[model samples]
Target: MPARILFIDDDPAGREVALFNLRKAGHEVTSAADGREGLAAFAAAPFDLVITDLKMPGIPGMEVLRKVRAHSPEVPVLVITAFGNVETAVAAMREGAYDFIGKPFHREQLLLSVGKALERRRLAAEVRDLRVRASGVGREIVCASDAMRRLLTIADRVAATDATVLITGESGTGKEVIARRIHVRSPRAEGPFVAVNCAAIPGELLESELFGHARGAFTGAVRDRAGRFRQASGGTLFLDEVAEIPAALQGKLLRALQEKTVDAVGADAPVPVDARIVAATNRDLPERIRAGAFREDLYYRLNVVDLHVPPLRERPADVAPLARRFISELAPGREIAVPPEVTAELERRPWPGNVRELRNACERMVVLCRGDAVSLEELPPLPRAAGERGGEEAQDWPPLPAEGFSLVDLEKRVIERALRLTGGNITQAAAYLRIPRHILVYRLEKYGIRRDG
Candidate 1:
C-alpha cells in the first residue's frame, strides 16, 4: 500500500535523491533539511515512515528517533548512517528505528526496508481490527460522546507506554474492553491477554490464582499451574475489581508489582515475570483506603495512570449508538431498524447499569420487536418504570412547610442525602444529583460538609 513518507538529511543531494525515488515508487514524500525540521514536520502531520540521517548539523538522528518514538511509538523510523557506521545504525534500531540504511545505499535496499516497515504497520492495524471483531457483543467500546472521545484519546496515548493503568467507573461500564484495546494497540499485541477478576475468586485462592501454584501446593493443586501473571507473558494482565483484593494479599501484590516477580504457592524461589498491569474497579479506593479496607501503597502501585469511564447516564450521546450496535450484533442476519422515537427514549432514560444494561435492553428489543423497526413499547419494562419513577419523584416533591421554609437548609439537606446515599463518594453523589462534580464540590465546601469517608 502507498504511504506518506518523511525523508530527512542535511545533504541536499542525498535528500533530493531519496525524495525522487520514494515519490517515483508512488509514495507521498516530505523532505526535511535536518533533524529539527524533520521532527517539526512529523509533529505537524502524520507519516507512516520516517527516514532521518544519523549525523545531522543541530539535532542528531538518535534524538529524532527517540522523539518520534515518544510521540508515536507505532510509526516506524529508518535511520540513515554513513558508510561503515553499521554500529551506530544498530544503536538507532535499539532506540526504536525500524531499519537503517548505509549512506551510499542501493535504491532497492531502501525500498525493501520501507516496504517491510509499511507492511508491518498494515499488519498491526489488521490485528487490532480483527481482535475487536472477534470479541463478541458488549466487548466493543462506542465513544460517541465527547467525554468518551477524550478518554479514548488519553487511552491511545498511554497505550504506547508500559505504564500500570487503573480504570475506575461504575460496574458494567466496559473497563475490560478498554484494557483489551490497550493491549491490542500496544507492542505486546501479539502476546496473550490474561484477565483475572479479583473479586470473584475467594481470598484463600486469590494468591494462587494470581501467582500460580506448584504441584501439591494445596488440596486442589493436582498439577502445577502457571497463574495469570505467567499466562500474560509479554502481554497485559488485567486485574478486574482490583480493589476487592484482600488486605493480606495487598502487600504481596505490591511486592510483585515493584519487583516484577512472583512467588508461587509452595515455590521456593521467586519467578520473574514480564506482564504489563492494568487494573479496574468500581469502588472508591480512597474511601476504602481511609476505611482501612485497601492499602495506600498498593493503590499507588496499581494507579500509575488513571482512566475514568463516565457512566451511561452522564454520556447520553452514547446511548443511541451503543443501543444500535448492540441491536445489530444481537440480531445478526436481519435488517432491524431502531426508530427515532425509540432512540430518543433510550437517550432520555438514566442507564444506571451503564453499557451492560443498554446492551441487555437492546437484546430484548431485538428479540421482542414485532415490526422491522423497534417501537418505544419494545423497551424493557423495568427501565421504563425506573425512568417514570424518577420523573414522578421529581414532580412529586414533599409539600413545603406550611409557614416558611429555608431553601438553603433544604438544599443542604438534599446534598447531604445524596452524599449519604452514595457513601460520601463525591463523583457518585454529583451524578445522583444530576450536577457536575465540581459544582457538587463547591456545594460541599460552601456547606462545610465532611466529605472524608
Candidate 2:
C-alpha cells in the first residue's frame, strides 16, 4: 500500500524536493511550511508518517513531537536536522521520534528511512490483527431496543478510529460484551482482544499482571512473563472493573496511557506498546474520585469516549429476546419454549443482575422445565414487590424481635435482600432501598458484599 506522508519543512526548496521524491516513489505526500501547519494538517486528517524539520521558526520539531505523542502516540514521527546536529536528533529519538535524517541527505536515504518506518507500522498492525483472530476474541452483539440500537450505532462509529472508550453500567449489564463488539467492528478487528478484570486479580499482583515482569522480579519469579499490555499490543485491551484498580497502580496506568509504554517489573527501561484501551466499570467512578480512591486524571484519560449501557429493566423490550437467546445457548438440543407468561414475569422484576441474571434464570428454566412450554412454577421466585401474591400479601419481611433487633443487622439484611432481588446491581439495589448509589456502595464494602455475589 502507498503510505501517506506529511512533510513539514520551513525551507521551501528542501520541502519541494522531498515532496517530489516521495510522490515519484509512489507515495501520497502533503507538505506543510512549519510545525504549526503540520499539526493543523495532522489534526484535520492523520497521516501514516510525519516528517518535520528539526529547526522551525515557530513550534520546533521537538514541540511538534511532544504534541503528537501526547495526542496520538501511535503515529510515527521522523525529524530532519542539519549536519553536526546528531545529538539533537538523538534527543528527538528519546522523546519518541521514530528516526531522523540530515538536511543534505540523498534521495535514497530519505526513501530508505521512510520505507523502514512505514514497514514497521504495517507489520505491527498485521501482528495485532492476527493475534486477535487466532485467539477468537470476538462475538456478535445481541440488542433489540431502540436505546440499545442507538448505543450500537455509536459504538460502530467510534470503532473505526483509535479513540479510547470507557464503558459504564451496572454489573451484568454486558459492558465487556459491548467492548468486544466495538473491537470486532474496528479497523484493528484482526488484532488481538485481551481482557483483564481489575477486580479479579489481587491488588499486589495487578501491576505485574498488567505490565509483565522479568525473571525473579518477585518471590514466585519462575521466568520472564509478558504482561497484558504487551500481550495486547496492536490490539485492544479491555480493562473490566477499572474502578477497582488500587490507588498505587493508577499512576503507572496513567503513564502507560500517556506515553504508550509500560515499565515491566525488574526491567531497565519502558517498553512501547500499541494497543487501544477500552475500559469498563460498574462502580461509580466519580464517587470513588471524591473518596480519593481513583485518580481524577486517569478517569479523564479513560473517559475519552463514554458508552453507558442501559440496564435490562430500563430496556424491557430486550428482555424476552435476550432470555430466548440465553435459553437456546444453554439448552441447544432441547426443544423448549419461553411462554408469554414467563417473558412477562421476567420483565416485571428489577433484574439487578441485568442480562446475566436473566440468562441464568433462562438456563434454570430450560434445565428444569418438565414440558416444551415453560410455566410460572418453573420460574425462580420473584422479588417481593413483583411476586404473584403481591408485596401487600407477602410475609417475606422478618417480624420485629421482642427485644428490639440491631439496626445495623437490619440494615445489612435489607441491603442483602435488595441485592438479591436486583441480582447484585448496586444501582438497582440502591434504588429499591431509596438510598443514594454511593451510600449503597459504602454498605456493600462495609458488609463485604462482593459485587459479583
Candidate 3:
C-alpha cells in the first residue's frame, strides 16, 4: 500500500525537509506548521504515518502524539528530538512511539524508523491473523483438571471448528489473549480479528454498538454505523465479559447467532453476517444461567467450546516467561535485565492478580529504578486481606471465614497498612514485609491497595 504521511513541526524549514524526503520516498505527504494544525489535519483524514517534532507552539508534540493515538491508534508515530533530549524520546517510546530520531539525525535513520514502524504494525496485524487460525476449530485443547482442564481441552478441540467459543477466567488471567491465540491457530488465519468488551460499554447502548445504528437511530447517532458483527464478518467477534451483556439483549444476540444476520438499530431488515463468535467472561455464567440472569440457550450456544485459563497462582512456572514478555513489550526503552534475586522474588510470591500484576511490577521497576539491572530491594510488598495488616484490631472486626477470607483481599489491606506503617516509604514497607520492593508494588495493585497519595 502507498503510505500516507503527516509531517508536523513549528519550524518551516524542518517541515519542508520532511515533506521533501517523505514525498521522494513515494509516500503521499501532508504538512502542518503547528501541533494544533497537525491534529486538525490528522482528524480530517486517515494517514499511514506521522513524524512530529518534540517541541511545538500551542499543543506540544506530546499532546500531538496523544491526539494521533486517540484518532488512529494503529498508525505509526515517529518522534524527532534534539540529541541531548533523549528523555523526551524515551517518554514517547514508553507511550508506544514506534521509534525516534535525534535533531541532527541521519536521513537514513528517519526513513528506517518510519519503515520499521509500519512493518511493526503490519506484523501485529499478521500476528492477529495467525493467532486466529491457531485457535480456530479442530485446534482446541482437551484435558480434565476436573471441570477446568476438561473445559480447556474442549476449547482446544472446538478451536479447530468455526463454532462460537466462550472462555471463562478470572479478571487477570488473560482471557482475551487466549482468544487471539485460538484465532491464530484456527482456519480464519487470513481474516481480521476484532474484540470488544461488553462490560466496558453502557447497558443501554451496547446493542447499537454490537449492531450498527442508522444516522437517526437515536440521539447522537449522527451517521449510519456498522456494528461489530458486520465489522467482524469473515472473522471472529470476541466479546469479553459476556456475562455483563444485558438479559433483554440476549434474545437479539441469539437470533444473530442462529441466523448469521444482524438488524441494525432503527433498521427494518437484518443484514447477513459471516463472522465466527468467541465470547469470554470472568463471572460464573452457569450460575447466572441457573439464576435466570443469563439466558440458558445463549449460554449453550456460546459455550459450544469453553476455555478456562489457569490463574498465575495455579501455574507459577509460566509467570517468569509471561512477565519477561510483558517487560520486553512495556519497557522497551529500559533494557531491564531480570536479576536472579528479582526473578526468584517473582516466583516465590503469589500473583493473585496474575499477568496484570506482573506487568504493573515491571512498569514500576522501570519507572523507579535508575539502572539496567532490576534489584529486589526495588520491588513492592504483598497486600493485606480484610483487616489483617492493621493489628489486633483486625481480629475484633471479624473471624476468618471457614474457607479463609480471600488472601487477595487481605494482601491488599496488608500492603496498605504497611505503607501507612512506613509512612509511604516503599523501601521501608519492603523491609517490613520481608519481600522484594518490586513484588510489593505488584501485590499492592493486585489487592487494590494503594498508598495514600
Candidate 4:
C-alpha cells in the first residue's frame, strides 16, 4: 500500500532524490530542509514513515529519531548515514529506528526498506486486532444514572484522541471499567490494554516493574524484562491507584509522560512508548500534593481529561439494575428473580463500599436464596446494623473494672483481636479496622505485637 512518508535532509540533492523517487512510486512524500523543519511537519500531522539524514544542522537525525519514536513509536523511522558512520546508525536502530541506509544508497534499496517497513506495520496491526478480539477486553458498561451516562459520553468523545485521562472516584466505583470502555471505543481498540495497580506493588519494586530491568540489574533480576510502558506500546495503560506512586519516581514518571519514553534500569537508551495513559486514583491528589505526598506537575500532566465516577450511593437509580446485572452474571444459566422489594432494600442501603459491596451482596443472595426468586429476608443486613443494635433496645455496656482498665492495653487487645481474626494478615487487618496498613504496622510496632500472631 502507498504510505505517507516524511523526508528530512540538510542537503538539497538528498531531498530532490527522495522526493523524485518516493513520489514516482506513488507514495506521498513531505520534504524538510533540516531536522527542525521535519519535526515541525511531523507534529502538524501523522505519517507512516520518517526518513532523515544522520548529519544535519540545527537538529541531527538521531534527535529526530528519538522525537519521532517518542511521539509515535509505531511509525517506522529510517536513517541515512555517512559510509563510516554505520555505527551511529546502528545505535539509532537500538533507539528504535526501523532501519538505516549508508550514504550513496540506490533508489531501489530505499524503496525496498520502505516497503518492508510498511509491510511490518500492516502485520503488527493485524496481530493487535486479533489479540483484542480473542481477549474480549471490550467490556459492556452497565449504568442507568444520568450522571453516569453523561460521564460515559464525555469519555467516548475523548477516546478519539491521544489525550491523557485521570479517573477519580471512591474505591469500588468501577473507575477501571470506565477506562476499559474508553479503550474499547478508541482508535487503538485493537492494541493491548495493560493495567497496573500502583498500590498493590511495593515502592521499591514499582520502578523496575514499570520501566523494566536489564538482566542482573538488581539482586533478583534474572532476565531482561519489558516494562509496563513498553509492553503497552501502541495501546492503552491504565494505572490504578496512581496516587500511590512514590515521590521519588514521580519525576521519572512525569518525564515519561512528557517525552513518551522510559529509561529502563541499567539500560543505555530511553525506549520510546506509544501507550495512552489512563490513570485512576481514589485518593484526592490535590490533598496529597498539599501534604507533600504527590507532585503537582505530575498531577497536571495526568489531569488533562479528568473523569470522576460517583459512588454507588450517589447514583441510587443505578443500584437495582446493577444488582440485577450482578445476579445474572453470578447465576449464569439459572433464571434468578430479584423481586421489587428486594431491589428496594438494596437501593435503600447506603453502599459505602460502592458497586463492589453490592456485587458481593448479590452473590450472597444468589447462593443462599431458595428456588429461583429472591426474597426480602435474603438481602444483606443494612449498613452498620443500626436498627438492630441501636435506640431503646440497645444492650447495656460492660461495667468498668473497680481499678479501671488501661486504655493502652484495651487498644492493644483490639489490634491483636483484629490480627487474629484476619489470620495475621496486615492488609486484611487494616481493612477490617478501616485504617491504612502503615498505621496498623505502626500500632503493631508500638505495642510490640507479633505480626503473624
Candidate achieving the largest TM-score: 1
lDDT of 1 at 4: 97
Q: Candidate 4 has what TM-score?
A: 0.63
lDDT of 3 at 401: 73
Clashes of 4: 0
User: The CA-based lDDT of model 3 is what?
Assistant: 0.76
lDDT of 1 by residue, 1-453 (tens): 789998989999888888888889999999999888999999899899998998999999899999999888879998989888878978888898889888787889989999999999899788776764564312457778999999999998898789999999997688898998888777677678888888656688899999999999989899999989999998889998798788999999999999999999999899999999999989899999999999999989889999999888999998888887888888888889988888988898776667876777788788898778998888875413324446667686645778988899888888886654544556566777886555676688788986531
lDDT by residue (tens digit), candidate 3, 1-453: 458888888888777777777778888999998899999899888787898988888999988888788666678899889889888999998877788888866778777888888788888778765654564532232222344455455655676679878787766666776787666665565576889877656678889999898889899989999999999887788998788788999999999999999999999889999999999987788899889999999999998866778766776666676667767777777677888878889988876555666667777777777877778877766665544546776656446777779766666776776665553555456667987554666666656666531
TM-score ranking, best first: 1, 4, 2, 3
lDDT tens digits by residue: candidate 4, 165-277: 99999877889999998897777887889999887677888899899999998898999999999999988999988998989999999999999999999888898999999
Clashing pairs in 2: 128-191, 129-190, 129-191, 132-191, 132-192, 352-422
Candidate-wise lDDT, in order? 0.84, 0.86, 0.76, 0.86
**Window of ten residues with lowest summed lDDT in model 3:** 137-146
lDDT tens per residue, model 2, 100-210: 999887999999999989988888778766776676777666778999999999999999789999999988888988999898878668778899988767778899999
Write down the worst ten-residue block by lDDT for model 2.
384-393
Model 3 residue runs over 4 Å out of place are 1-157, 333-335, 389-453
lDDT of 1: 0.84
